[model samples]
Target: METVRIRNPGMYWDIAANLHFPPNFDASKHYPAVVSNHPISSCKEQTSGNIYGAALAKAGFVVIVPDASFQGGSGGEPRWIEDPEQRVKDYRDVIDYLQSLPYVDADRIGILGICGGGGYSIKTAIIDKRIKALVSITGVNFGRLMREGFSNFDPVGALEAMAVQRSAENAGASQRIDIFLPASVEQGKAAGITDIDVLEATDYYRNRCPAEGSGTRMLFSHAAPAMAWDAFAFAETLLTQPMMVVVGDKPGGFGAYRDGMEIYGRAASKNKQMVVVEGWSHYDLYDHPVPTGVALERVVPFLVQHLGEAAVSRVTKPAA
Candidate 1:
């Protein structure tokens, strides 16, 4: 586990990230690579990023988890802006670095994204076929949330508010307006954030595994553009890479009910699978060891199988 900066040439700023090398990792021998994408408003050091990256490394792949531009420690203007296109570009930019490393097999590269990152990874894999395999765990596309808002959320009203926010923002407004998060869980619950997904995540992100630059607020002005984008709009025609989308089995009355099934079906890949962890919600898989374990059970093999035969013969030995 080491912090490394991956420079995105001609971009706003370099992505601050962590590079993980497998145990007994022989720098002499090249290894397959896994690029991880964290949830929105999260960084590489968090439970979602670190846990997944470390787990994959333990499974014998070199993993790099880069903080999205403008989020985490990465650089971009008007901080906290969640530009979907830039987020997608961030993955490709990171891959640009991975492919440069002498120890990374360019053709044997895969990606793993959790939560919102999963949504972006789907898009990234669609156009950037350099990624041989992809895994989206408890995946979410903010396009739906942005366009429609979440459960019990009003898109029309939200759009109306965003229109107002955009005017103030484009005019160089400095004050921050948060559209989703409240200052605290109690406040959020009182403010109509009763959904278990937000509630449970509030507990962890606010308490358990929070870190620097892992702030939970997005600029209100970003609402309109974020809502307009569809994360899986192109999955059917463009997403042909081997894909694995993991969703919680037991519907928690929300996203889990159909969480990633749509994207799974939309993918044009002849090789794709959906894993449903029993009795979990979308957020449950973020840090919950049980479901995370379930996700790993499938993802490890899915990645190994698709990345290349070299990884299969070398690092991914049967867990004894």
Candidate 2:
């Protein structure tokens, strides 16, 4: 396991990235690399990104995990701001850095995005032809989520609400955001898990993965409205690359996972696959070992088959 710091020349954000290679990495071999995107409000240290990187490294593929802009050690003003356009650019920026490396197979690059990062990854693949393959894990269609509340798809109403929130934010007023967990576990029970999957989500954010460096309480006042905009307008037309969508069977009612499958099904690329792990909940795909292994098993082979053997060696080799 090796950590590398990369500066995004285009965005001017200094990104902290981790690269995991197999025990026998050879400088002479050019390896295929998979760039893994972290979930919303998550840094590279989170279970979803690092666990996947470790799995891919063991599978003989170079895995690059980057801290999303405005989160963790990555640079950005107005911390926790979520901009669809900028997020997609961040993905491209990571690709640019990867392609510049001597050990990377430029043509065999792949991407894997978990949770909110999944949506950004899909959007990036649409515009960037350099991405040869994609994998979205329990991803969200952030655009739709912002425009419509969970279990409802009222574009007009959602946008109207966003407009109100944006107005307050622009007026220098603090905006209210969903608090997935309360200050105490007792309060969490009363809040009800309907708005959130308590068993999976609450446990991790509150007890498991709290923001420490900047402190995890990061929430965006303006970015919530930006999500209401249609980030996937070109989803059907732009993405022609091979894709894999993974989801948990339990608590699968979350609209984003279904939307991901719909997006993949409609993609211009003919090669695509969808997998659902039985009894797994949405957050289970992140920190828990069960869903993590299930996800890696599918993801590793997908990249190997698409990116080929030369690219795999780079991940397995030790750095010089």
Candidate 3:
């Protein structure tokens, strides 16, 4: 377990990353690599992404966990600005670094994105052919989520509001917006929880995954309301790479999973798969044990199959 700080030219900032290598690492052989992106508002140290990175490293691949642009150890101004374009570029910049490493097999690079990151990862795979495999867990299509709030996908008013905010933001006026927190668990107020999904998200965010360093708060204030609008668009025509979209069967994620599947199904790629875990909710797939296990089982095998035996074997070999 070692942490390395890498500078991202794409975002013009430094990214704090954790690179976990198997107990035995060999410099002579190039290892397959997987870059794991964390959830929104989370740093690389979050248990969910860390657990997955450790799991992949144990399976013989060198896992790199890079802190997303505006949060964690990464550099960005006006923290939590939620720029989808910059987020995707951050992953690309990480890939660029991975390719430059002598011990990494450039052709066997893959990615795993969780929660909000899942959408970014999907967008990355669609645009960057360099990525050989992708797995999105409990994914959220930022565009859809923002346009149509949870349980509904209506962008009419949200889009208009964004336009209004964009104007205010351009004019250097600080916009006033509501900040939803897990502590505000009084029905219909949690940040990412939906009526359809389990109601435990409030507890999960407040108690289980409290933010570390800087502030332990779970929500943000006035986070560039325009970010949601910039996160997604009609990207159906851009994806041509293999992708694996995994979502819990519960209500919180059903809509998102369906949306992702729709995108995956229409992709021109010859290889794509969608897996839904029965009796699982969106938050359940975050750091929750049951959903995480189900996710890892599907993801590890998928990467192996798509990236090829040679790549997996190379990464898994015992260090001399």
Candidate 4:
């Protein structure tokens, strides 16, 4: 395994990344590749990106886990701003970098996205046909989610927040994440946001691998573009490749799990499957041993089948 950075001189800037090479990688022999995207407001190792990336490598494909533009190690102005259009493009930009490698089989490339990245991966596959296969582990389209309901189950509230934030920006004021995202567990609980999913997120951003810049903050101006795009809007026509959607046993009544299932049902792919890790919650599927283990087990075989002979990876089961 090695860490590398790809400089995007054309626009969005630098991508900080961790690259995992398959066992006994050879300089002359080309192998299949997979690019995994992390969650929103997350870094490479903060979510399932690192876990899944390394697991894919063990299964014989070279893998990369990257931070998107304007977040984590990637360069962009007005930090932590989310751009749905450009973020989808960022997946392809990572592909551009992967295709440049001498030992990578460009035609056999696959993409994996967990949580927010999952939604973006679907959006990317809709346009960028270079993505041969798609996998979304508990993926939710924030565009659709925010457009429908963001906080207090009010979609109108989210849209209004966007307009207000943009207006504030014009007036020389910037948005702060603390307003919607509590900085502490106590804060979230006090605000009655104590669901298992949010609590998991709080614990995640507050403790494990937190120093890597994983948190729940973003520029409110990021909402406008999100309000405009739909990750699965064209899946019935454009998303024709093999795809997999994995979620845990329980969705915890959060709309994300249901949204993920909807994405699966809406995909146009003749070859698609949804694997559920029984008895696990949404966050359990993120990084916990049992669920992540089940997810990778299903993901490797899916990639191996669709990515063709080059992706017939063989090493061992994913690490817990």
**TM per model?**
0.90, 0.85, 0.81, 0.90
Q: Tens-digit lDDT track for model 2 on 58-83?
A: 78777788887776777876676667
Top lDDT model: 1
Q: How does model 3 fare in lDDT?
A: 0.69
Could you tell me the C-alpha RMSD of candidate 3 in Å?
Answer: 4.9
lDDT value, residue 130 of candidate 4 = 92
Listed per model in order, the count of residue pairs whose N, CA or C atoms clash below 3 Å is 2, 9, 1, 0
Question: For every candidate structure, what is the RMSD over all alpha carbons to the true structure, in angstroms?
Answer: 5.0, 4.3, 4.9, 5.6
Question: In model 3, where do residues sit more than 4 Å from their true spots?
Answer: 8-11, 150-178, 184-198, 213-237, 309-320
- Select the stronger candidate by lDDT from 2 and 3: 2
Error of 1 at 301 (Å): 1.2
- List model 4 lDDT by residue over 66-159, tens digit each: 8878878777877887777888877888899999987788788999998888999988988889989999988878787666645446766776
**Candidate 3 residue pairs that clash:** 148-154
The segments of candidate 2 whose C-alpha lies over 4 angstroms from its true place after superposition are 150-180, 195-199, 211-220, 252-254, 310-320
What's the true lDDT of residue 27 in model 3?
63
Q: Kindly list the per-residue Cα lDDT of model 1 for residues 1-320, writing each as its tens digit.
A: 87888775687578888898888877667789999988888889885556899898998899999988878888777788887888898899999999988788888999889888888888888899899998988888777766544523677778787778688867987646463555568988888877677777787687777788786768766646676787888788889988898998755433533648888878899998988888877777878888888889898988888875333323444988
lDDT at 83, model 2 = 70
